[model samples]
Target: MGNIVKSLESSLATGNLQKMSETMDQFEKQFVNMEVQAEFMESAMAGSTSLSTPEGE
Candidate 1:
């Protein structure tokens, strides 16, 4: 996340849409990894506690 933020800041400083797009891809990758981890944690916790999420999600 910090890496993405720094990358985005640099891209903004240079006004580089290409770099910003690359940073967005990095951010998407981070989100994917996070979701995977969250799912794993929820799966692991399911046996002990009910997994919770916001309504409609």
Candidate 2:
């Protein structure tokens, strides 16, 4: 809960995609395990990104 939020926030601040993904996985697991009702929201910008961009390109 709070931990995941902090972790994900730090990841976002540092632009750490790996950390973000891992934190999100944990977050999702917690919610699903608790049977928490979820509603996902998305905007058009959600689909307009690549997962990989080389470090020094």
Candidate 3:
């Protein structure tokens, strides 16, 4: 009985670890994609004008 319980616990632990690892991987991928989008937006905003250009200087 004790051996069976131990085995079951170990299996559960392994499964949980695997799930956590997958979650972490997914989160990292999402974070990287977001970062890229942010960078693109930053660059775009830097050179963008608000349709208000002054007359010829």
Candidate 4:
């Protein structure tokens, strides 16, 4: 009986570790995508304003 309980506990611990690893991987991917989007918006705005400026007043 004691050995059976130990086996079950080990299995549960392994599963939990796997889930934590997968969650962190997904979080990293999402963070990188957000950073790219922010950079694109900043450059686009700068270009737009520069184009609209009047020439030689």
Runs with alpha carbons beyond 4 Å of true place in candidate 1: 49-57
Look at candidate 2 and give me any clashing residue pairs.
none
The local lDDT score (0 to 100) that residue 19 gets in candidate 4 is: 57
Q: By lDDT, who's the top model here?
A: 1
Candidate 1 lDDT over 1-57, as tens digits, reads: 998999999999999999999999989999999999999998889845544654566
Our model 1 lands, by Cα RMSD against the true structure, at 7.3
Tens digits of per-residue lDDT for model 3, 15-41? 777655555666677679989999999
TM-score of 4: 0.64
CA lDDT scores, all candidates in order = 0.90, 0.77, 0.65, 0.70
True-structure RMSD for candidate 2: 16.6
* Clash numbers, per candidate: 0, 0, 0, 0
Question: Candidate 1 — what's its lDDT?
Answer: 0.90
**Candidate 2's residue-wise lDDT over 1-57, tens digit each?**
999999999999999999999999999899896663332323223433333545575
Model 2 lDDT-worst window of ten: 36-45
What are the root-mean-square deviations of the candidates from the true structure over C-alphas? 7.3, 16.6, 11.6, 11.9
Residue 8 accuracy (lDDT) in model 1: 99
